[model samples]
Target: MFTGLSAFPLTPMNEQGVNEHEFIRLVECLAEAEVDSIGVLGSTGNYAYLSSEERARVAKLSVENAGNVPVVVGIGALRTRDVLANAENAQQAGAGGVLLAPVSYQKLTDDEVFSLYETVCRSLSVPLCVYDNPGTTHFHFSDELHGRIAQLPQVASIKIPPVQNDLAAAKARVAGLRALLPSDVTIGISGDPAAATGLLAGCDAWYSVIGGLYPEIALALTRAAQAGDTEQAIARSAALEPLWALYQEYGGSLRVAATIAELTGNVSQPCLPQPLRTLQGEARKRVEAVIDMLSLS
Candidate 1:
């Protein structure tokens, strides 16, 4: 079900819980833009920062606001039982599917990863997308482990964030994974800036951040790449390079905060969990410059 640009909408928060009103406005914008899918509670959604109850509420809210678009809720938690709980709630909230990642404080092994996914999958009737974001999870999956997870029942897709952004290198990686994965299983690219490269190389979707704020730009870029319009695709994605550089320089959390702030102003200012600061100094200035030039006017 994941295809084109899947907008990873941010869960903008202040001291008082989720700021539901602001969150609603953001989802409404995405619905109006007609993004391919709305992925709430992803790392971009700050799933780790909210409680299971809070996440369930966000899932239900997204579905209500999403209109014709599919809503995939992230169900990554530190414990297996917690993941199961999150999945149960998401299914109950009428979510189209669930995105899962091995969010761990302690390092996890292949067997452990398989069992966690297996447990969560067994409890739900909805499709599951394996979120392979090593930067957040700290659990890298070998090709062998990735293949094993793809075999699980109800598993429909794998979202891969490439270690390197080089087009040829990214293509080789997608080819290797495509060979091991079942023919029906979709390969999604979350390595944003490399997304054009990945889509050009045959990935089925782009799990995106900018799409959350600028879906029109995102879809145009996706269409270009999908139609083999190499120059258009590269140029469109290249226009996003400054923001991508900031995502690399700071992190997704910081840069995403900056992007949303530009989109919706101070209400969208980030309130990450302890030890993580919002964008400041030159980082914030760089985000403003990129947003000024590239954000929808």
Candidate 2:
């Protein structure tokens, strides 16, 4: 089972709206950090904005740079065929596994959700991780549903994001689900700020986006927690909190991605499409100051 941190690098867009070399360089840094794994074209990867070709190219480059580290491609589309195609391309590009979200369009039932996962598990030769992002999906999974998904032979893990309400309840649900699932099946948490807490709650992995900028700190925190040093983990997490604060300040994923790109020197010009506003004034200045303090770029 794969454990620890899995850094999801942001997919960059050049002036020509192309994913540039700078983006690939960022993934290489994560490889240098020796993170447990890499998730390509994930929500943080801006999977929704890129063209199919662009998505495949990013996945290929991510895997190549990742070397021995496992690369998990995010395959979430409105249609089943599209999701399958993406998965096929990731496999062809040498991805270690595929992380799937429920098809983003239309209201889907629990049966449809399981069926989508079952089909993907049956179609792909690689491992599968279910992304239970209820914030986006608007449909939460029950412990019984989670256990059922974990029982599938090809399904290896589940990615649960930290919800705003009743975190203790959510953590308890994961603990109970973990007990019900096979010993090999891992339960991962996706929120970067609550990573150490999630691991303490029995999550096997922390799927992170901010780690792209401070992979060493992120990895250190996870190691500290796994080694039973809560003080060490808490101290490292305290130092790492500013980066997460920047993400929250932006109030959007694009700015979060831009902050990461700027911190890593991945690209000097990071732009967001329609709907996602740009950072400016006090907000941009504050983010820049934090970036400088970390000396990440």
Candidate 3:
């Protein structure tokens, strides 16, 4: 379930809360594309903003609509007790795995973070993926800390941040992590811009944002790299430079993704939760221009 491409779709919202019809459509789209797994309630799904009830519903909706695709639900929360609840909900919703980030308001010590995983792992029936998304969670996982956490019984994968762009450096970094993790535990790379290099460098999987929207192209890159077709994978990634630039210019993938979703009519305009607005005016124009130039759906 951990290997290959795991597409993380946006949890489109309306004033009434999660737009179940649209969210299901997104999940069905991914399943039809035959992605390795569907990641629901992820950072891209705005897990942090949704209430536990909303999250439980989203998890259920994703798994129910995803056909045979394995569903990995994000169970991150500010409190360990809440994380446990989310984990239980995901398990009940039949998630194949759960992704947990050490979400925190105050700075957490290594021991505190370790304890959080320990407590959650004890209660989990499903496998857990360590979500080391420092950009959102604000808690960084040192390599040493990662080694320690990977030893936990249910730890199946570690979703690391982007690798260095240089292939050799990326390979070395992935090699170092490989030594720390058990052979059964895989390393999945996030950061869409660097995915091709990371995959070519030996990371086992791509925990992809772009894959959620453009599964065919992302899968082409994944398959090319997995087949050791370096030139093809690099060229494919290079073709999407304009899209990656939009992510950088917009501060992150969330706004740009929501913008694309809106532009494509996959979801209603103003799809994001309160206070998290989509790109406006010129920023929106640039995103549209890039989408057209790239012929992105």
Candidate 4:
């Protein structure tokens, strides 16, 4: 049920490992700012890197700290049964809804992918938002496949990552998909920079990572978009351009969370694990310089 600005909090970790205090503090700060909602244990939260026990702890603390705010858990995995199990856990933990990404890797046929989602749809009690992030998932759900899954009663929203870089093409794709689906189904646009673009195009909401680190700014831009104030939205989004630039420098999606931890001073060690590459030396200095330059808070 999240619409405007939903901040996806970074799951704080220390040198010794899990940093519950840091996580709590960040959540508290975001809550105080009154973001539209909080998405716990999403891609930004590094759910894939966490153990089952760690997931439970993070999910529980995230829910507890969120209080009355709507919190959606990202229940995603490489297999079917595990995704369903995670969904059940999220429901038990009192999440408002779930953002379910299709199984990453293993390129499946349309029928196979539809069947996987069908199982999750039938099992989860809360509403489901299908997350379309083909960049990492390997399998991009075609319009026909999306239509097939859209028939499920639990399907509440579609979080499209704007698969095609061309804004016009993206709009066409989203429009075509929307035309096939029911009118009430919400379409949430991912890719933060294009949030305003997506809003102008007819998506119901914007799923954001940058919003986690800068709730007020994100909210301001989201509000402007909702109000159809293009000039205001552009100005607000532009203010965070430097932060977005830093994200691009670091490589993949993990940089989004890592940058948030760096700017906010929440996580003890924001570096990614071995082989994944960590920011140090010149790289670390450049990242820190950008942070100092932006004075992002």
Candidate 5:
């Protein structure tokens, strides 16, 4: 479940809450495309905004519609108690795995972060992926800390942030982490822009945002890298540079991804949660232009 393309689809929403039909369609789309896994309620899925009931329902819907594709549900929360509840909900919904980020209001120490994983791991019936998304969680994991948490039971994979653009440097960074982790624990790469680099550098998986929207293209790139076709993988990633630039310009992938979903009619006009608006005016136009130019459906 940790290996290959694990697409993180957005949890399309409406005034009535989660757009169940659209969410199911998105899951089925990924399943039809044969992605290695479907990650519902990730950052891209707006997991932070959804209530516990909504999250559990989303997990159930995703698992129900994902066909044979394994589903990994995000179980992040501010308090450990809430995190455990979320984890329980995911497990009850039949999630193949759970992704946990060290979400916090105040800064968390390494010990606190480690304890969080230890506490959660004890309760998780399914395997857990350590989500090292410092961008959102604000708690960065050192190699030492990652080693410590990875030693715990039920920890199957560690989703590291983007590595350096330089392939050699990326390889060294991945190798360093691999040496610390147990042989059974896989290393999955997030940060879409650096996916090719990370995969070509010997990472085991791509926890992708773009993959959720365009699974065929993303899967091609992932397969190329995993097959050791370095030139093809790099070229494929370069082709998506425009989209990656949009991610940088738009501040993050959430707005851009929501824009794509809307543009493609996969979701309603206002799919994001309140206070988090989709791309508008010229920004939306730019995204539309790129989508058309790139022939992205």
Candidate 6:
């Protein structure tokens, strides 16, 4: 199963489609940096925005170019059929695992959500992770729901979102999940700001966004936390506060990350959709300063 600091890369796109050549280069960079794994098409990868063909292409590109690193593809969709199709596509593309969130156009009942996963996973031979992202999906998974889903044959891991702005509460959430989930299942921390605390509190891995752009640092933090080295973990975690603060202020890490790639000359500026935009004017300068502060530039 995929674990540790799983870097979720931003899919570089051009007019025609996903920029295959440059995207592969980014994947190779993660491999060289020795990231524990690569998560393609995650929230940061804009899974909801891309076409099925684009997702399939990125999955193949990542798995092919990742060298020895495991590639986990995000396969969440509004419909069960679409999610199943995505799962099949990723599995066919040689993905290590697939991350699935219950994104929906309507509020889903607990039974509906549970059934959705049971149905989608029933057909897949590959292990799947339940992505309990309440913010995007708006479908909350209570502990009871989690227990029911744990019984599903293909459910191997649960990617739990950390409680925003409350690292201690986030730790408790992970602890609670550890208590409720099957012992064999791995618990990964996804919310960026709480990753260090969540890992220290006992989550097995970090499903990271910034780590996609800065794998070495993310790897350092994850390893330190895994090793129970509080000082190193705190140091690395503290270093990330500025950027994390921006994430909280701007309400997301997507735009901040996309802007960093542009400012650092990693790729041409990413084309984010409406209501979400890269940091601008003073906000842009502040982000650059934070990058310089962390020496990420």
Worst 10 residues of 5 by lDDT: 14-23
lDDT of 3 at 50: 96
**Tens digits of per-residue lDDT for model 1 on 1-297?**
687878887787755688788778878888999888899999877899898889999999999999998999999999998898999899999999999999999999889999998888789898999999888898888888889988988898999985355677777888999899888889998867777888888889988876776778889998898898978998987887876777777766445554545444735555555455566777666667767776545
lDDT of 3 by residue, 1-297 (tens): 998999999999966799989999999999999999999888999999999999999999998999999999999999998999999999999999999999999999999999999999999988999999999878889998999999999999999999989999999999998998889999999999999999999999999998889899899999999999999999999999999999898898999999999998999888999889999999999998998999986
Output the better candidate (1/4) by TM-score: 1
Q: Which ten residues in a row have the lowest lDDT in candidate 1?
A: 253-262
* Every candidate's lDDT: 0.82, 0.77, 0.94, 0.76, 0.95, 0.85
Give the range where candidate 3 is weakest over 10 consecutive residues by summed lDDT.
14-23
Q: Which scores greater on lDDT, model 4 or model 5? A: 5
Q: State the lDDT of candidate 4 residue by residue for 88-110, as single tens digits.
A: 88888888888888766667777
All candidates in order of lDDT, best leading: 5, 3, 6, 1, 2, 4
- Taking all chains together, each candidate's TM-score versus the true structure is 0.94, 0.91, 0.99, 0.91, 0.99, 0.94
Any runs in candidate 1 off by more than 4 Å, and if so which?
253-266, 295-297
RMSD (Å) of each candidate, 1 decimal = 1.8, 2.3, 0.7, 2.2, 0.7, 1.8
Give the per-residue Cα lDDT of candidate 2 at 280: 66
**lDDT at 118, model 1:** 84
Show pairs that collide, candidate 4: none
Model 6: per-residue Cα lDDT over 13-84, one tens digit each: 655567677678779999999898899998988889888988898898889999999888999998998998
- Once model 6 is optimally superposed onto the true structure by TM-score, how far is the C-alpha of residue 41 displaced, in angstroms? 0.5
Which lDDT value does model 1 have at 158?
94
